[model samples]
Target: MSLDEVRDEARAFLSDHFPKWRKENNARGDLDFEQQRSWQRYLYEHGWGVPTWPIAYGGRGLGMLESMVWNAEKVSAGAHTFFNLVGLGLAGPTIIARGSDDQKARYLPALARGDEVWCQLFSEPSAGSDLGNITTRAERIDGGWVVNGQKVWSSGAAESDRGMLVARYDTSLPKQQGLVYLLADMHAPGVDVRPLRQIDGGAHFSEVFFTDVQIADDDLVGGPGDGWSVAMTTLTNERMSLGGGFGTFAMSFDEVVDIARRTGRIDRYGLVDIYARRTILDVLNNRVQSKLFAGQIPEAEGSVIKLLMAELGTLTADVAIDALGAGGMLAAEAPSAQQRFLGSHAMHIGGGTDEIQRNAIAERVLGLPREPRPDKEVPFKDQLRS
Candidate 1:
């Protein structure tokens, strides 16, 4: 089928399913587990869930433009691709790029179908953006490796089936050269997941502890000492996945304008400025998406999108509240507005922090002086920790 036909069919299906399903669940947040699973199964059956993957792996083998159209149709219908964001977007693509045939055959279909969920175990107490600084150790043994470590800020770890893990396999080498990436079974013995309470009253972020947990040799993604390269694939794509929606600002902008217009506060809310800024960002985001569709990941584009989105979301929320006017303070959208404001705070932290992204844009994208890394050449055993 042509891309437009595929989108039209998807639109018809989503129109039939979404509105009633959303009303039944009353979920302003993410859909519940069963609701998500049923929808995912429907999409899988229709070959729409993992559109970018090969047909052999339960995808539609769609081209980039088709994939874009499919996502647009779903979003326009308010149908989310819930339950498989991490699996399909991050883990699945990374596996396709780096995993072995056995690994791909074993894991890809399950992940695509949402039978197994995955989390990332890259960050630790001492490592967030500086992932090379992680202290997680994996000791080589007879059949596999035994791991012992604590990973913090793991999203969805509490409910995950597996995780993509990076641990030090040769502490004798330099920090970045000693790492290995592995697929860890979250349900394996000696694995512990504890959720951390956040200011938003959600415990989605978790602490994962692996005490003598064993991972098979076959679980490795790239060869030993290749973790950094393998990991960069996931990280780079993560930035795109998180911020690609900035191109769709018009929908959100229209919603905000409608609320203000109904409340009769459009002039008082300084919406003109909001409109101008949002339109510029929307155009920039479109260009970024076009580059993405053409297979050129333009330098600094993701960082630019992420930074602007964080700034724009916060600004939009504040303006929306003001636009609601005094009597509208107690309006139905007030709580949702407050929730969105609080949620936008996380956009600055997740994927990569604003400070980290700005530094990346400065050093890597722009022709700026790179920051000095005293430990870049130091052996892992001798490297000083700040």
Candidate 2:
């Protein structure tokens, strides 16, 4: 369908369904768990959920442009998208790109329909940006694999049904080559999830522990030793999603302008600086989106955009906080200027650190020589011993 047609249809559907759902749940704020599931199911049944996914996977098989139109309409109608963000944005896309047919059949349908929530079990205490340094081990077992290790900084792990995990499977190989990616059941016998309280007092991030947790061979996402490549796909999608403004508390330029006006700081030079940066951010985001629409993966571009986004978020929040004077110290609810300032800190840390992104941009985009690593050719087991 044409963009106009897609927009009209999306607006009409949201108009008819969203208000009813809101009224029924009396949801003046965010939806509860059950309400989120119900809303997802409602959208899936009507062919709006995961609209960019293939029809066999519970979507309308729409293109990126159409999906953007649908989402724009949702924003206009004050309707939220699917609550299972990791499932739809990160895990689902990775599985489609590298998973076996059986894996796709088993996981994608429920994920797209929001019957299951998913999380990424990639980061660990010792390895956040350096993912290949993770020490989570997966050993070959009788009927499957037995996992024993810990994952930290997993968002929504406490509520996830499954997780996309990367573990060390062959210590004799190089660190990046010895890994395996798998789908882990969060409800498995030895799996534990502990929510980590944030500065905002929200437990959106969690620590996941796997102690002799058994995963069937069928849950393997790709061939053994292909974990690094599979993980790259997931991480690339993650960076793109975050850079696209999926999981951020970023304020628009207009919102910043309004805050400045409200606090009598409209004439501040910071406003001009923020306006210039916001314009640059919009251009970068548009370039990334255009690449995606053209069926290209913007790996280095993703890093650049993510880096810019993090900087922009922090700058915007800082300006707002300064504008608010002492009022910023008095905490309001979330998305308030004060809360946003605090939350913006996470943007620099999540997806990938700003330093990591800068390194990626330097190496991948600017064609710079990589930083020398003594462990580059070392075996994983030897590196661990060192």
Each candidate's lDDT (Cα)? 0.80, 0.84
Q: Residue 19 of candidate 2: its Cα lDDT?
A: 90
- TM-score quality measure for candidate 1: 0.89
Model 2, poorest ten-residue lDDT window?
240-249
Name the top TM-score candidate. Answer: 2
Cα deviation of 117, candidate 1, in Å: 1.3
lDDT of model 2 at position 3: 87
The candidate 1 region of ten consecutive residues with least summed lDDT is 242-251
Give lDDT tens digits, candidate 1, residues 1-386: 78679788778878876776677666566668767876776677767768889988898787666676777787777676557567778899999999999999999988877788889999999998788898999999987899999999988898899999999999888889999999999999999999999865578899999999999999999899999899999897677666545143222677678778788777544667667777777677677777877888765977887788777777777777777767445635566665565566787787789999899899987779988988887889997777
> Where does model 2 exceed 4 Å of error?
245-248, 332-335, 384-386
lDDT of 2 by residue, 1-386 (tens): 99899988888889999998789877768778888888888788888878878887887888766776777688778786548889999999899889999999999989977899999999999888788898999999876799999999999999999999999989999889999999999999999999999986689999999999999999998899999999999987777666553423477677778877787866568878877877787777777778888888788888877777788888888888887777778776225677678788898999888899889889988999999988868998888532
lDDT of 2 at 287: 79
The C-alpha RMSD in Å for every predicted model, in order, reads 3.1, 2.1
The CA lDDT at 273 in model 2 is 84
lDDT (0-100) at residue 134 of candidate 1? 85
Per-residue lDDT of 124 in model 1: 93
